[model samples]
Target: MTAVLDEAIKKASITWVSVGDGPAYALWCMPVESSLIVVTGPGEQHAPGLTSAPTATVRLRGDHGGLIVTAEATVTRLDHAGEEWAEIAPQLAGKRLNASGPAAEVVARWAATGCAIVRLTPAEGTPVTAPHLPDDSAAAPPRETPARVETRRPFRLHRVRPPRT
Candidate 1:
């Protein structure tokens, strides 16, 4: 199961994570050693309650885009001034697409803004996989946000014509 979990994490570009019973959030993750790294804060992705939570449930997708595995992970926040950050931050920045600037600059900005770099280490146990998976699709309604389309409908191009004789 460990091998399977590791391979899934490596192949996955994004993973769904839910802390406690909160809604799962899709976060861009990088497989670092045996753990997955995710960044969240003002300028990065927003994963509410993740930084404060000690454990989280992670769902990885397979090649067919279905849920492949679900595992419980131990969460650890990296200290920006620590050596772990010194080594991992650059790698994460490089993997980050559409970064505002170079890797070094991006790392600097994240540190300055106090972004949370979270590492999720999959716990050793029997992960939910294969035939044991749920039968129904776990789809949920979209969360409400302030951003929405408020524009009126567009005008018709052609005018209505009178009935033909």
Candidate 2:
């Protein structure tokens, strides 16, 4: 297995892609032994009771059995102290996460919005990783070089207001 796959399996944290009323948002998810923690922003969309917590429909990409946790869940805010620690720790641990204060606040603010914390237990076989590159053999036909295509675009930005309250 490649280092990426190995790390993915070992990583306690995974990216959480939340699909909601508006555009999708991706958060960093830290999976503890049985539960997960995330960092998000402070807004009605993310607020508890008002905003919906994302499902644990994680798509693991790996060589071994990638763990797909299919189960009901609850959401909660990690205390301030815990959130602070999670910010700096996840990076040092070499997991996928965005550790900004705004992101962490989203998880911490869950209580104010009355969002429930959930625990996910896998009910089915988790998806596993497969090799992305094909295996090479000594008997394989000789290969030829291919031409390259290059394109470039200047940076641009288009900003719009968030949806109505």
Candidate 3:
């Protein structure tokens, strides 16, 4: 299933839902080994609160269909040096937009701003489930700001029916 998920996320953004961060999708995600890796912060396109999450739901959507992978997220400081990070650094850095020079150099500059690389693995002891989240692919993440606090609106359904022959 991870193999199937890998191919999907590689083709489309993952709808990531984590506590406090609401939900956000990313176009800058990569499947590293058996796990999926994503980098997000002020300059990136995904949720920054992923760093504070221990568990989150990751959804992959594409022409091949979609799958929901409940994952345990581990936050790693990309600025640090480690053997595991070393091996994947190139792959991560190469995905950085407009990155110049080698991966090592790009990583240094990328991580210099307190950014992080998040490694997500399928949650242990939990079987992969059917899509547990409704499709929000067309909606933006909800802002929790005070100005938006009074904007709660109930959901309404717009039913469509084909004309009877």
Highest TM-score against the true fold, candidate: 1
Q: Rank the candidates by lDDT, best first.
A: 1, 3, 2
Instruction: Report lDDT (Cα) of residue 89, candidate 3.
Output: 64
Give Cα-based local distance difference scores for all models: 0.91, 0.39, 0.59
Candidate no. 1 TM-score: 0.92
Q: Write the candidate numbers in order of decreasing TM-score.
A: 1, 3, 2
Candidate with the greatest lDDT versus the true structure: 1
lDDT of 1 by residue, 1-165 (tens): 467788898897899999999999999999987789999998999999999999999999988999989999999999988999999999999999999999999999999998989999988894788888898889999889887767997888998799999
| Local accuracy of candidate 3 as per-residue lDDT tens digits, 12-89 | 444454544455544466776556677766555557567767766665555654444444444444444667666776
In model 1, state the lDDT of residue 71.
95
Listed per candidate, the RMSD to the true structure in angstroms reads 2.5, 15.8, 9.4
TM-score, cand. 2 vs. native: 0.33
